[model samples]
Target: MFSRKTRLAVAIAAACSFNQALAAEQEQLELDAQTVVGSADESAVDSYRSTPSSAATKLDLTPRQTPQSISTLTRAQLDDFHLDSVNDALKMATGIQVQEVETDRTYYTARGFDITNFQYDGIGIPFVYGNVEGDIDTAVFERVEVIRGANGLMSGTGNPSATINFVRKRPTATPQARIDLTGGSWDKRRIDADVSGALTAAGNIRGRAVYAHENKNSYLDRYSREKNVFHGVLEFDLSDSTLFSIGHTLQKSDSNSPLWGALPLNFSDGSKTDYSRSTSTSADWAYWDVQENRTFAELAHDLGNGWQAKAVVTHVKKEGDGSLFYVYGTPDRDSGLGLFSYPSEYQDENRQLIGDLQLNGAFALGGRQHDAVLGASWSRSELEDISWYDTTTGTALPPLEDWSGNIGKPLNDAGSNGSDFTDRMQSFYGAARWSLTDRLSLITGARVVDVESSGGNYGSDKTTKYSGEVVPYAGVVFDLTEQYSVYASYTEVFDPQTETDASGSRLAPVEGVNYEAGIKGELFDDRVNLALAVFRTEQDNVAEMAGMVGGRSYYRAVEGLTSEGYELEISGELLPGLQAMAGYTFVDITDANDDHAVTYSPKHMFKAATTYRVPGLEQLKVGASLNWQDEVYNGIAEQDAYAVVNLMASYDIDPNWTVSANLNNLTDEKYLTSLYWTQAYYAAPRNASMSVSWKY
Candidate 1:
């Protein structure tokens, strides 16, 4: 646990040292680059999407080529939209909704279910409810790909809603470099730099390095943060068909006086608007610090005979220390609001390891074309969490300076104790596709998974791992014309429940089925891509939150839950001088057991953006985007819908120099971005930023 004063001192020292090192490194790099000119393109999109020097598997396989629905967010889209974080990028995607829990915590949902499973370069990283941190930054990724429906084939035992994959940027055979600096309101400042080039004269080896730093103040009092990140990758071409890559990432973050829990919504009169934006209760002396390190290695081989093999291994370690403040109910809600308050301190450490292998190839059957894939994966994770609580007796007694020294003793009789948990999973799967004709295809897949968990304060017990249901998939794609196609697909997914009952028995896994039909087209000489899709999803044996009546979380099995939706999306270059990307979704989620609308699903969600270069000013480019979501209830209580507008402008001062500005929440709208059963969190206020970049 860190105190505010100590954390601030440490941050200052680190920043000073970092700046000195950066200056020295910049000078050295500049001198070396001046001696030789690089051939790589300096454009952000080109650099981000450059083909890997090492031969790798292509991601654009047809629905028939793969037994799943895959979606991608490209680097061009990220740059056009100015997406700075993973949360910012996902909100614009189809069939995905991101809910904000706190300033630093976010929850992801898809197909009317929460998505708790994630992967980096196809390596598993499991996440639990109570403890979530160490999120990866978008700066280090090349692209994001999502597999809709169940992904037991690769993720082992996990959520069926969706499986997210983040592809790390790898080094390129061509040399390139870029640097950007940004400053904005709330004393915000950020810098990002990327450099990549061939590591060997023969071009058999390449390497890439990226560094990013961000510091800013938040809307809440005494809330501020600083983050530092570094990413590096090396690639080697063992042969023309075989390649290997290794990468590592390190991140450190510090937050001043983070809040433990949100304030309750209602007062004595049961009115919802009883809280004040300026209300103060959190001790100014509290602080939080987090550190994360991750590394991975991957190898791929392409057998000229239409066969390919790939393997990946990854490991991650994270640790955190912090003090947080939580607000509780008072005896007299109307009169003694400040009398009831509790502060807690926590320390946590987590580590994970994962391995994956896959083989894919094409074969012929019954005079028709067929593609097949077989894969297996294993993962293990361990976590330790400890916490201490203090309860003060008076109603505003000591000053901020003395709060830490004159605190009460621990509240829990268990004293300063901790809990340790471990989770392990193994899975094997196979899938194949049959092309009935040049215009039609059939796809199917199945998987078996075994998962185990143990080691907690209540003692450890392992249940005989049960096999997951056999998932089946089918799809059809018809090429209507050179530029148009129609597709339909059905997929099934299952998610095992790790939570145990009072008798320590594992609950049945949840089952999900999805139906989808869509059309995809390319116009304007294959420059523009557009799609429209209608979809429906149903889940069986859904896990429902029962209640937390006595400080313990409880859940029950619900029979049926259903979600249906339609989406429209347009991407790629729209015109010679103009480019645009946009999407709209209409969702209707319901609790099939009661036929009531699901609490968190929005009815309408939309996003659109376009960028165009000024006719006379070739260096000037301007863009604007709109984001909106219809009203949805918070639990059973209704909340108002909200929308926000964002604007961006960039000017190329020269071929190697550029400047850009961005404005978010342009209207200064006040609305809740997300709400829990009894609480709401405000969206970010209107903010603006300007940045300068130089590339070589």
Candidate 2:
């Protein structure tokens, strides 16, 4: 971490340089309110103008005005591209890296670190753990926004990679309804319904509801999944200047014979094992299930003088239960005999509560008009897990005669254990954007955070608390012309570690400092946005898992890591009826000595997607996307570079009816999505889906 004196010096120098440039163009600049275009309503999904975003700075700033790299996957984009799940959507995003640790466990990384922060409707929430198989269904969301950099101003504790913000679908003043049915390969079936309108004739109360169900079988033998989602929201206009909204969301997921891990890659003889793409190592009895519920309320009041006060509260409860059978041990090339089955069952419950209150307004300061936001937030998350493992020693289950899909379930019922974890955080944060001139602006913010975590095995507990940690943020943006802007930003983040030093004393938290500079352009009346940025992130006290001590595993926090990367992105309407989005990323990460490289993250990635409507046949539209990534390395193996392309087409049969079809993995490229020391997970092959919809 940089010293306070150094940070201050850097900020002052950047401010002076930006101020000088602003003065040169002070006489020819004009500032106007950021564009507020049409809403991302249900029917309009192809436009790419990202405006009035509250995720990046909690202010009315367009993507071009925000200092960080931000991306929004709008409803149109999701629907047109058939991004059904959070994982699927993120894979199409630029500069994002998704790793599948297991069939159900996934992780997202950017700028060389894991993304551990998330939000819903501008409210902070616990990080989404991939092991839970909770995808945060998109049926209830209007868009998914991502900020790729440190965001400690609002997120109290996290990494510097990225923060995800989910914007919920809101009640509309106009009546609307839609229904859709879909069928696809593997006997996949899906149904969806959405309705929104004013509930009262006076137009003081509005409501929206969404319902969806899906069931599908996978290529893996005997594996199937079913999921359901329900979302409802209501808005009340308490008074002319006051509004209140309440909502509820419920989701359930169930899977049969789910695979815990991929098949082994090598045999005991050191020869590579070639398994079919449809191979499964899971027993017929293995299953995974999850249930989640959330209730939330928000109040907003105008405080006069262009100021507003808002308050939000949310409660979330989630339960996960699953049984897993893992296949281990290197097998003999000929007999396939050395493998052993380790069966386990687990159940867990997670409950969380979050509250936030903020005030925002525009004020005159230092002879300039400025915008500022002040907020305070509190959150608590509690988790409890119970697990049972097979401990029958001596004899193992009969060895497999052949690698077939049929395997008998084991019954051991030998050992059991439980654990509980709780996390609490309270923070006060504030930020202001000062318009030094019509063409120049300076943004700065800070957060004072206090966080604590307590948990342990059933019989013992340990508590760690971090207090009075202050994270600062600053940025400068200067408009070089009406269509071009350049900016620089610095942000800090801190992550609490569970590791202890050699003396058994817990080490200090991991510290990260991120530096970024970029250029932005807005063309065609701000309908098209483009950006190019270069960034470097420094980390100190990075923790690495070490050997066991005193019968318990620990970590060493003496390691240092650094990452440097550059990204170029373009998104918006390319023509009258054509929308396009494209991005390319390059990243390099190394250890303290700059020799050993980080694993699992690709060095180069490129993504492009476009949709075009027939100029005359306006009812017909076609879209396609291409995702390419450079080679990636795991500790045990390396995966060659690969590219996957997808195509989609939609035709409106009439004013109220439409049909769509999507084809994924058009080339049926075979590749590995993840690699472990002994196993490898392969990507799915070609698949197709078609849907029919009606709206009124």
Candidate 3:
């Protein structure tokens, strides 16, 4: 797997070199003709609803036309809310939930299940839990798109949660530059730079680049993090009707004294620990580090006659290393001890290759205009993990005297064999939209997917395959008026299971079906949008974590799991100079036994934000936000209901200069963000940041 990745990297490098040389020569020889200038497709929107998306069906469509519950976080919104990470953006999206299972390991879910499917620019990619790929910085993205419920029509395989799509910022024909510097509580410091413009004097070639760096101390004692990222892209006009582009990104993150798990909820005698939120479970010697790289290339051609074809290729490589200690065993309140340490060290790498081609155009069918798309895609992901564990006899050191963060680090001498896993998938998909009438439309799509996974241990060697799985999707939309539309959609997806039955035989794959109906409306000349949707999902062959057997934990298959939910969202500008976004979600989950099934999925969640410009003082703006969630549980531990409020203020010194201040947890609310099976994680306390931004 490593060799394959190395070869691919070298090939891409050579291609990039050749492209650059060719571009330079073309620029020198055809300097006068290269004066034909091009502009970026992106548009600045004053309201959330002004942005159009292509994530739902891989077609340029508004949120109301997608026939599903969709939400977007625009760059303007991100700036208003001070969202720095992908996790932060998702948390603000409608009906979405995020949890920090461990330090630097955040997980996302929608409806009632974990989200495992992710896409970049409408292309599918692999996502795994406890991987830093899920928590990368969001500075390079122009916006984030989310589709609620099953999305099998576009994503070949995934859980029934939701699909998240990140749209990258494109190069601009007009020269643009921006810089920001920030200082905040907890000794936080950050700097960001973005620049985009024509690369050649004749304006035939364009380029964009983004760079960001941040270092901060955490609320938890003895924990600190540092991160740096760089992204660059170049676009060249191969001809009047063709375009070529290539991009690369590099990001690195390091967390010192990172905890493996949160503090315990109960003591050894079954008594509550009631420890302070500032308590830490990690030692100074523990750390976690991650480095990731991505390279991509694209070619698009306008075939003329209202037809176009596009091909894209992307490669991602992520490497992680960690040495950590977990504090778990029940504690003894009387003796001030009962906890034990499980120390280990590990190194892992994940590599992925994805390619897709699509031909889309408008055609006259049966005396009416229709849109159709034919596409094929191939993707593969490979992962390898190597670890060393502490093998001391008794596995118990001296108990802590006062149960502080002064635990000693143990030696990791015991060796463990490495494990490797690989997944490959190929699919053919097609979709078409028929304009039956000016007010009604019918859209249908399907994908035939062939997927296989192999590799476990060097000796054990296990494999799983699912061939010829057909996932179908359909939707209907009726325009009640120029501003209102009603729609319904049905979609399905499947996941191959790795869990085994009691007899140790692999279980069948899980299947999911989603039914949705919604009413959408656009107001203020399509500058404001609103949607009310109700959804129901059914799953068969669901996998659940089972109790330990043979001194190791395992998973089992369960049947008859259902989740029903409703979402309400309103976004965009109610009036000029005033922007707002509000959302509320309610969900209910039932298991095979007809009981409350999901422990981590909250039944109620809500988020809202608004920004207003002072009527007379056009240069001053004020904003506020609210985030609330109902109580959640993991096994016996429960996280109580919580609500937080944030406030922001900004002053535009001039057209090119601005200063802003952000205050989080305005009321200083104390809450728990996650309740894992073994421990509880607390939310951060009140914090504030001030920044100055200059744009030209």
Per-model TM-score on C-alpha atoms: 0.85, 0.89, 0.91
* Total backbone collisions for each predicted model: 0, 1, 1
Candidate 1 residue runs with Cα over 4 Å from true position: 1-71, 157-160, 274-281, 330-339, 391-414, 457-464, 498-508, 545-554, 635-637
Colliding residue pairs in candidate 3: 268-331
Give the per-residue lDDT of model 1 (tens digit) for 47-71.
2111221101122263223333445
Q: Which regions of candidate 3 are displaced past 4 Å? A: 1-42, 128-134, 269-272, 393-410, 457-461, 497-508, 545-555
Which of candidates 1 and 2 is the stronger one according to lDDT?
2
Number of the top candidate by TM-score?
3
TM-score of candidate 3 relative to the true fold: 0.91
Worst 10 residues of 2 by lDDT: 31-40
Better of 1 and 3 by TM-score: 3
lDDT of each: 0.65, 0.77, 0.78
RMSD of each: 6.1, 12.2, 6.0
